[model samples]
Target: MAFTICYAGFRSGFFTIDHIHTVKQLIEKCHEYNRPLAVTFIDYEKVFDSIEHWAVFHALYHYDLDSLVENFNDLQRTLQQLYDACMWVGLKMNMSKTKVMANIYNVTNPSATVGSEMLEIVDLKTRLYNQCVLPTMTWTLTQEAVYRMRVAQRTMERVMLGIKLIDRVTNDQIRSRTKVKDVGNRITKLNWS
Candidate 1:
């Protein structure tokens, strides 16, 4: 293999750690340049299982690239090889749910992003105010995504109460009836217990 994935510090076995690290590094690098970074979170179907094992790695390690065509030839060839190897072992990649999102962050102009096929560029600054910038209390917010979540919670609550949403049942009324603790309260109770 011409390219080898650095497995030196991957003992933690957590891909999210890489995600977080990537995001942090992106933030730092973009902050320096005052440029926005877009991150596409791909939904690979069982890639880790196929690539992480010693048997598959050995297969890919020996697979040589004799013929090449266009861009990303190595990636294309390697993927085909991996697919063949996995099929031989009775495993397959779900190419349908495999979303190839290029990036999510919008810096200056969302339109300025690269390789944009069908990515919807949402304003992270506005939506992430609750989780990224403000306190968790503030995350129970009346903002765009937050409002939708609260509305969903209320709708579910109303459904449980057998009440029509058009009947003008307030969220407070549903809360009073259900007496269900919110997630934060539940967490606090668990900690205390």
Candidate 2:
């Protein structure tokens, strides 16, 4: 089933190691199709350190683009309003390093960034990828696409562990209960229930 989490708290924020699973699934699919896949890593370090007031306010109020455009003033006014809001809240956006691009976007799959400039833009699927990569660093918010492949890998590991445990337990139970005259009969009775 598809999962949708509308709202959540800070401590239990939805970020998890789901990307690791998706990467595995993608690799498997590539092998099946005999296709090549390219992967790249990008970094945004200490972004919050340089946030100017305007950027924070812009992000806060201008969440949805189509809706925000209705109230769109010139960039100067919009940035000013954002700055005002930041002053009120003591927050800022690092203008110099705040990277915005047509194709490059923060997604849930933080590790695997997908951007095909030549390809027509498909529907964007975004998930939050927040993390405190270092103990001293602050938590950062990011969004990315869900990686199906990582999920497949995790699912496989769980299934394999379960099978192994069942086998070991079943063997032990059979050996321990060998004295029972009707072992198969007892097992059949348990199965039906």
Candidate 3:
């Protein structure tokens, strides 16, 4: 069974950045040691609403995973076992959304299958770029949007400082008094990080 970290609602202290860093370190270590590493990402369709809690607990209690999976066959077997368990629990795995990533030094292609479908293999770099960078690249702020945001910020600042446009206050003076970061600069910093 796959365990996912949920960051919604009141959950605290578990961040996605920690997972990304851990994965990066694992990949680096595997590359440095010239070890073959294959990672499978599984996605379940409608897990929360479809699956029953009692069935989930029963599946977890019955499932036995003892040894480390060393190769593709073992991985495939493990996946099949997981698929069976999930099927028993009324949870459906989305085959199209599942993907496997392996190290570049691996000579043989890692073929992992669930039921009759073969999972797609993706390059780590491509996957990372697509997930992390592509969205940032595609997020464009229009001039009108930026102007509106700035105006809103100024209005908020004026309300906080109890000042109006007739007060003849400069934006720099208001910004210095308010000590708040500019929206544009904040966005730039967020994108950089």
Candidate 4:
């Protein structure tokens, strides 16, 4: 069974899976090492309980991991080992949906596999961020959530304009383009006099 960290139903405390939490962890570890640490965040789909316990334990014991940090070579090797472990345990990885995000000086694309398909870290993040993270963060419709959604929409609009997805952009254009409600941006009827 997955713990609170893996499943919403079991959530007990503040989630450490968020980017802010991950960034804090990275900074803390980097300070401990006394050098800037290049870090990557990997996410898997349906990761709740699909993995076999024995396989997980075996992989953990087999690998000499001092905090799951990986260099390029290590990441490749670990990817191979992960595939092998999944094969032995009858577990399948969702590579297309899996994501890897990194904050580093420079990064070459890293790769992972799912059922003979190879997926790149950067592209995986682009797809999954739009599909998963953005929606989950925006769905609550609270003041903060609504504000974030608008900010994201604006950023996306800039990207769209940069890529020539739109001829030009205006506030009206942005408002018409997205269904996201700009909840806190408007004055209420009581305040309008």
Candidate 5:
């Protein structure tokens, strides 16, 4: 099920809040029952906004399903079917961006593939923090902290480039040679995003 903001009509309902509440309730139920829950969040890279509205509805209607698979093989098959369906509708899935997350209790190392590339597996909480929380927190860094980060990054870059402090290379020269963005600028871009 999907809950989206109603942009064209009356905006009385808090759909985003309701969606979060529903997810929270599902998590609580899973915890209470001591059952493992695996969730896959698919990023479409603005596929809906780029496509015709009716095409979006047609794609959804063609691939709608609500069921749980019994094993990783079944999951792989299901993902293959999904990939085929998306390709049939002229949508491409970026396999590199796809990730599979499972709880610690899950013994099998979950393996899934779309076409020939294997999807990466990541720890759920770590991925959530890295993707959701860390970017926001980066904006709050003090000047000193940012300076330290830049110093560390420059040191690493210098090491990779076989340069040393005694080499008499200027910071601007090193940066021009390395072609990497400054830590502060990267953080600013992250905050804006």
Candidate 6:
């Protein structure tokens, strides 16, 4: 349920340097506070086509959330309504044809699915060190940077896989299985190495 803030004033792109700087500062502050942090991008430009239109209206009516929250009761009521709406929508969600959150109770699909997939892949890679790939002596500053680079490369590949999968799905083509298998191969290669 990510929203893309697009100001028509800026023609170059959706986000600017200020946005990055603000996010960087926020992440830095989270680290300083010893809070677990995660950054993810979600695209909802074409979400309407995939969603049940009536369900969105149903959610809006049931939740009746305030644009501004005043109290706990309001929050509870709003949450209940929202949950009901999501449940109605999810029941109709095509599992075989539609991709939802892979391993969560939340709405991880709707385009943020890529972020979850990448996070899962990163978690998998991180486990390698726990399995004795990186000893204390070798897990110094330089090795940590190299490990980060590898993670970044794998993340990029996973992102590419998401793009390819989405394209295939949208185009109504016959390459879905092949695309998934290709991503699986890449994941296997990463794990084996």
For every model shown, what is its TM-score relative to the native structure?
Answer: 0.32, 0.23, 0.53, 0.40, 0.51, 0.25
- TM-score-best of 1 and 6: 1
Write candidate 2's Cα lDDT for 24-109 as tens digits: 68656744664533322222335356555345434545442121211113322444554445544555444433322211222312
Compose the digit string of candidate 5's lDDT tens values, residues 93-155. Answer: 767677766553444456777789787766554445345544544556777888777787678
lDDT of 3 by residue, 1-193 (tens): 3344532222366677776687788878877787777788889898777976657655655786422466778888988988898898888889999988775555444588898999997656445533554344323477666566667777766765557899999999887655555666655566632
- Candidate 6 regions exceeding 4 Å error are 1-15, 45-193
In model 6, the clashing pairs are none
List candidate 1 stretches off by more than 4 Å.
1-19, 46-117, 130-193
Better of 2 and 5 by TM-score: 5
Ranking by TM-score: 3, 5, 4, 1, 6, 2
| 1 against 3, candidate with superior lDDT | 3
In the predicted model 1, the residue pairs found to clash are 38-103, 39-103, 39-104, 40-102, 40-103
- CA lDDT scores, all candidates in order: 0.46, 0.33, 0.69, 0.50, 0.62, 0.38
Instruction: Give the candidate order by descending lDDT.
Output: 3, 5, 4, 1, 6, 2
Per model, how many backbone clashes are there?
5, 17, 0, 0, 0, 0
Poorest 10 consecutive residues by lDDT, candidate 6: 99-108
Model 3 vs. true fold: TM: 0.53
lDDT of 3 at 38: 79
Question: In lDDT terms, which candidate is top?
Answer: 3
37-118: candidate 6 lDDT, tens digit per residue: 3333323324456676555655655555443233334433443454455556652322223221121111222122221232
Output the number of the TM-score-best candidate: 3
Worst 10 residues of 5 by lDDT: 1-10
Query: Per-residue lDDT for 1-193 in model 4, tens only?
Result: 2232332222466454674676687767755564423444444445566775655555545553344554655655666666666556666666656545433222444444544766554432234545654444433355565566667666664453233435556766654433233333432222321
